[model samples]
Target: MKRTRRRKFPPCGRVGKWASKHSRSGKHMKTKTGKKYWLFHALSILLILMLVALMCLNRGNPDFQNYSNFYWDKDDFLKRQHEMGFFWLTRLGRLLNLTYEQFYTAITGLGLFSLIAWFYRYSKYPALALAFYMVFPFLLDIVQLRNFLVMGIALWAFSLLMEAKEEPTYRYLSLSLLLLAGTIHNTAFIYIPFWLVLQWPSIWVILSSGLAFTVSLLIPRFLTEASLAQSSSHVLQRYAYLFRGQVSLPGRIFFISLSLALCLAVYFIQYSLDQDRLLEAGVKPKAFQSLSQLAKKLSYLSFGLMPLFFQSVDFFRIFRNFLPLYWLLFSIYFLVPLKAQHKRLEKLVLSLFLLGILCVTCYVLLIFSNTDNVIRTVFKENILLRLIELRGQ
Candidate 1:
């Protein structure tokens, strides 16, 4: 008798089965995404811990001695021709009755945590970006503690700037963070004009960066330390040293070639993105587009200033500031897109490219360790072993 009611129930049964399957698939995806997120977090934390251990345990580091001296002499520290953020940090450390070791370690840990956290949160391939950072700039940044701290702050501000397009209030917040970073290290001010023109066309960005580089070149020709030393402005006087030194011929060639190669790679990636409409289909189209444009502009600026690198190694600091953007660009456009293709050839190519990067990075680290007495401290001993020896001593 119930057979009459059971008739024509096929649509409802099919719909129920489809919904169940869809829900299971969604749940699996969510679980997979969550695991990946935690994995990245764990990796980031481990990296931060390793870096902090290396920097903090290396008491023989020349910069550590210099920073300690600065900490001991509060009045002299405040009076020095340095940014106030460092002075404030020293003051706070003293107020807390922290020893020089504790103070240094705390600041170093905090700065590194911030920097790695930013990379993990925003970067498409955070691990790759972190690896790139370690290869090129990690040692240098740790040596220059103040600059490292400023970089951490500047990157945080940059994250805010990235979100500013969606939420206007983020723009002001980004500006405030940048100002704070400037107080820590005046180079942060260089990012202000960049932030101002983030929405500009790629061509305009290229032109402006070229013009800026040209002006920078002219400034060295016109204004020497002698001229700047006589100026009333402390900022100008502080930068006078940049106009003094001459980089070696080998150094010039190496840096210029590296910059040129990187610039060409970025241009190639940009071309590919455009031709394939990858940006349109990318995870975050607008954000990635801005990243691509900014990366190109910064690459051009970095390359254009390579000649200046010959004038002074200090000019390379500008290149360092732009380095992270390059990592992000390459990771996003080059690697992420390739990953989506799931082709064995693409995967093999990616593996080889990464291997090449790692080899180059190792070569650089070895060179730095051998050439720079100060940097040699970093590689002299295993950090854990060093700490244990210190404890025993």
Candidate 2:
């Protein structure tokens, strides 16, 4: 009779433990990757498809109609709500004679690609990064063109900042790009605060946000009394808009509740993981502290949106500034096991995050399926069929 051998399986209690600890172990990485890695990627791919589906389904929107006003008359690219960069983009599309919808679709594709390029640098979990970008921000991107562009490039700048400590070139470049990012969308202004706090100490970010919030309240009074509100830039107008109670109550509640869940889930993961960073290779205490500080600041910035949600339902749009970091931390959280507190806090946070992630994914899927265009996009129309028809025309 041939000798039989037995293989050890990870225990039920320590499944999260073994996965976190041993996935890095040379002995276990290959054997364990199939179980943990595949599931994560599968979920990621599903979310990515939904992201694309949303953009594809929304071939034309109010923004496109706005763009059409400029394109039809072929007017001079004047300084409007859209900054120079955006007008130039529209100009190029109009010059090409591509329909506004086609041009928008193409550029949106490029934007998604640019996002992938920026996020690919700091993350190992590509699926999660793509999902994060393509999901929560999906609604805003559908209607807001400049914001989509600004968020993508600002994140590109943030990716540069993440490496600034080790690379002086990246440090200077990150700051310059951040300033440039501001011109594309006023929302990019948040990058300066994040960069400053990260370079100095992480604690100041909360103080900065508190100060800005106070300052924003003061501005609305000035803008209201003065004739400047009408002449102000779109972004400034947005600030003026956010300071007053302009948002719907039901809409604000839903927006704030969703944002709260995401922020809480991310914060818990970071808190749980901070305890174990010392164990990872090349992860210094000071470096991890810097990251922890960034996480805290981002979380606080995210929470600030809650009060703003009352004033502007679009307040959640600002979360785009901190989005890359959230996804980055999440990617790291999954990669790094909860070691210090070991199993208890680890599983608790991990389970919470998993629950939150799944809920968000399912929610997006359900919402997308309910759209009228989805049926048209899936069966009656598709990229390939559209391409053939365009050629025939």
Candidate 3:
């Protein structure tokens, strides 16, 4: 093979040289990106652990129902499994089962890990993302809500979906997981539509949302009948405390106006910002940034609307139902491009965020103190329920 010894390859002399150069450049880029991602993940995990720890420490004893009382629910579900129960436990237990004492510990550890994973997978600044998620008002208010377990599960599933490379298989799996999670709690239903919008935007989402709206319009009737049926037999006097709260229209109008104003302001500001940075960020800011920004601002402003919503409508009793939407929408801003024209503006924004956090902490403490009970209520009487008038009359 050396007989003709093609002239010794020289730099820039052959196509091979160009290919080699390109490969090296690509590898370098990959390495740099990988380093940044790992650093972000580590910081996210550290921040998440710290925040979770703070949440645990400051979890005040509020007068509310607790999840510990659900032993009967779990036991009943197990009993109904019959012959399938032991086999399911042996097999499924290997996957999800820990002893009773290990239950909460497992949930906490798994949740913390899932949270860290989600930050890394979702946000470029993972640490900041986790901090924001932790500080979210709804999350702060519903620390003891067992229904949120579904959300935790869905979050983990979403993380996996984000990382998955395949198309149809992963998308289907994610949907199935989302639906199963939704079944765990009515609030989980929000995730389903959101997932559809993110995944199958072509057909499924619009149809599903429209169908869902129609179905939602019918649910009250069905639920009312179910409540009446159960009232005769249930010792807790089913729906005994229904329709107990009211809010004035003037208050609703005020909140809606405030939310709309905030939305308009953010949209206008974001629309006037630089297009280059926005485009480079993989976000179509030049085209849809204004609308997205408005939606985000409105979502945050919607938190303030919950108090108003509860005051206005007796049927929309679960304000927490909208919370995930609030958090999810607000998180979109982190992906948007911001000029931060001056250090002062940046500092002002940072200060405002910090002030918001401080206010939330104080509010948490005030709510806890205002509660007329000793032990931390895990369920029916927790901050979220009372805030939504879901408490017994």
Cα deviation in Å at residue 317, candidate 2? 2.0
Residue-level lDDT tens digits of model 2 in 314-355: 555666445665665565565665445556666665776655
Instruction: Name every residue pair that clashes in candidate 3.
Output: 64-377, 65-378, 65-379, 66-378, 246-311, 247-311, 247-312
Q: Write the per-residue lDDT of candidate 3 for residues 229-254, one digit (tens) a residue.
A: 45644422333344234556664664
Give the TM-score comparing model 3 with the true structure, all chains together.
0.51
Off by over 4 Å in 1: 1-45, 74-82, 123-125, 230-234, 267-287, 329-372, 379-383, 388-393
Candidate 2, residue 348: how far the Cα is off, in Å: 4.0
TM-score of 1: 0.77
Clashes of each: 0, 0, 7
- How well does candidate 2 match the true structure in TM-score terms? 0.68
lDDT of 1 by residue, 1-393 (tens): 565655555587898999999999999977986676577557756766667777665555557677888888844543355577777888899999998888977888788778767765555346656766776677777678888887777666765776776898988988888788787778777778867765576677678778776876786789888998888877887788888878777776777666666666666655555434443223355666656666666666665566577787666675566567667656555444333455556546644664464455446434544446645676564467666778999
Task: Indicate whether candidate 1 or candidate 2 has the larger lDDT.
Answer: 1
lDDT of model number 3 = 0.45
CA lDDT for candidate 1: 0.68
| Models sorted by TM-score, best on top | 1, 2, 3
